[model samples]
Target: MTTLELHGLRVRRGGRDVVHGIDLTVNEGEVTALLGANGAGKSSTVLGVAGLERDTAGSVTVDGTPIRGLAPNRVRRAGVATMQEGHRVFGDISVADNLRIAALLLPSPARSGAVEEVLALFPELETLADRPAGSLSGGQQQMLALATALAARPRFLVIDEMSLGLAPLVVARLVPALRQVAESGVGVLLIEQFTQVALELATRVTVLAQGLVTLEAPASELRAHPERLTAAYRLTA
Candidate 1:
């Protein structure tokens, strides 16, 4: 089975280390939720895995191939893509153009097909393809951001904060799309703040607190014993 592994991963920002050495893994066809409170180093961990952090250490591997220090684009080419926090999209450009730009990493002949596949994943974007991304609502922008990542056709995807500012209804709409991606055999690392949302969607869960993993277990186990999660979060608080 294919896997995305992060072993003893560390990330530093500004002048201090924000993420201590941590071990985590995302298996193919599964959603691995990296849950934590605000500033728990969840975003830092995702950045390190995506090769966006210059001050990082340890191993980031996909199927046993090391890709720790590669550039972000290189990491994507290695079948790992990150949908960063906040709905990041080209505000000035049309939605289709945003996807087209993301597909630039692929062969020219395959770019259009790649965009089409991503649109299929989020059909909500089809009618709005000609609209400016900046004009879309927060939820729409988030969908576009996710579609942009999917345009690269990654085998392993890391999404940071999929439910940042959207309403519960919007998040509800987006959740099924994510599950569809995982069902299609793409390994997913979901960094989320809402415990209930993460627990429902994840097969496995890892809790981070103060730059360290406080709990790691199957989602079913954690869901059954909610106090364990509460205790894990209280450890750093």
Candidate 2:
């Protein structure tokens, strides 16, 4: 059931370690939410898996194949895709074109079909496909980023800061998309701000503090032991 595994992973920024020998596994078909306050090494954890930051030392395996030295595109082709914060899409390009650029490895006939697949998942994007990406709202952009990742048909998704700034309705809408993705048997690693949202979707959750994993428990257990999470995050005031 394991899809992605990080063993003894260490990442450094500015010559100082930010992720301290962290280890975690994302199982197939389950939503594993990685939760923490800002600067909790949550992003670093996800980024390390995506091969975004070089100089990271650890073993990252996808389906048991080592991905430590693989390029971003290679890592992505290996079925681990990332939807980083801000949903970095081409602001000047049409949504369809943006997807086309992302579907670099996708063949021609399959590309359109895949775009349609995401459109079906995010129906709001169907009408706006021809419009420039910059024209879409923040929520729309987030949906597009997620759709783009889905288009690649990744087995595991690493999302960072998915609900940074948005209305409650928009945030509410996003969580279901994640559920839909997980229901389809894809593993999801979400880094989120709305603790309530994480509490709701995560089958399992882990709490990170100052680059160290402090608490990892079933979401249900965490809910019952909210004080443990609070203390791990220094929220005991």
Candidate 3:
């Protein structure tokens, strides 16, 4: 199985280290959840891995191929794609056009097929294809963002805050879709704010506190012993 590895990763923002040296791994076909409190440097870690943050030091590799420090586009070309927070999408463009644009990295012959596959994954987008992206509800926009990322056909996907401000019902709808993505063999690094949501979707869980890993355990173990996660959080506080 393929793996995305981060070794001794460090990230600095505003001239101070936000993520002190840390190690993590996301294996293909599994969801690895990264859970942390606000300001625990989760987003910084994601940005560093995706090459959006330049003040970073670490070895980010895919199956031993060093990809750290590469540009975001380069990272994507290396079979890793990131869906950043805020449900980022081209608001002025048609929903179909956004997917089409994301597929531009693939060969012309494969682009249409890629778009079709993403649409199949998020069938709701197909019905709203003609509408501008800005017109969709927040949940719909988030789905579109996820679809755009998948249109690239990446082997690894890094999602930062899959559930932030959306309603509970909307989050319920997204959980299964994400599970299908992981089941299809894409390594998923999920940074989630909702602990239960992460626990439900993850095979393994890694908790960060004060920019350090406070706990790493099987999701089943944490689920069975909820107090363990609470203790882990308390350690950082």
Candidate 4:
């Protein structure tokens, strides 16, 4: 199985270490939730592993091959795709254009097929293919961002804040899609603020507090013992 591994992972920002040494693993066909309050270093940790931060220190590997220092594009090419926090669709471009741009990483012969497959996964996009991405509602825009990531055919997906600013109904609709992605054999690292929502989707869970991992356990264990998460949230807050 394809797996993404992080060992002694550390991230520094503005001359301060935001994430301390942490070890994490994401296995294909599983959902791993990274949970914490604001400033708990959840985002920074994933960004560093995704090669979006230059001050990152640690070892990141895919399938046991070192890729900690690679460029973001190279990391993407190695089968890891990131859906950054907030909506990332291009406001001025057509929805098709947004997808096409993301598909650029694929080989020429595969680009068109990739776009078609992703759109199929998000059928709502097909009806709005020619509409400007900026015109879509918040939920639709977020869905587009997810579709764009899927267009890359990633083996490991790192999504930062999947439910930010989304209404309950919108989130309800999107969560199943994400579960489907995991069921389809993609290793997913989900950064979510809503504890209940993340727990619902994750097979395993890790909690970061004050830049340190306070909890790492199977979701079933946490689900059975809900009180165990109190320390993680208290420290993060």
Q: Model 2 off-target regions past 4 Å?
A: 235-237
How many collisions per candidate? Answer: 0, 0, 0, 0
- Weakest 10 consecutive residues, lDDT, candidate 2? 228-237
Worst 10 residues of 1 by lDDT: 228-237
**Candidate 3 per-residue C-alpha lDDT over 1-237 given as tens digits, one digit per residue, 9 for 90 to 100:** 799999989999999999988899999999999987788889999999999998999799998999989999999999999999898999999999999999999999999999999899898999999999999999999999999999989999999999889999999989999999999999999999898999999999988888888899999999999899877775663
Across 9-75, the per-residue lDDT of candidate 4 in tens digits comes to 9999999999998999999999999988788899998789888997988899999988887899999
Top candidate on TM-score is 3
lDDT of 1 by residue, 1-237 (tens): 999999999899998989988999999999999987788899999989989997999888999999998999889999999999998899999999999999998899999999999899888899999999999999999999999998978899999999999999999998999999999999999988788889989999999999999999999999999899988876773
Q: Please, what is the whole-model Cα lDDT of each candidate in the order they appear?
A: 0.93, 0.85, 0.93, 0.91
The reply for model 3, stretches above 4 Å from the true place, is none
Per-prediction RMSD in angstroms?
1.3, 2.0, 1.1, 1.4
**How big is the positional error of residue 203 in model 4, measured in Å on the Cα after superposition?**
0.5
Q: What is the TM-score ranking, best to worst?
A: 3, 4, 1, 2
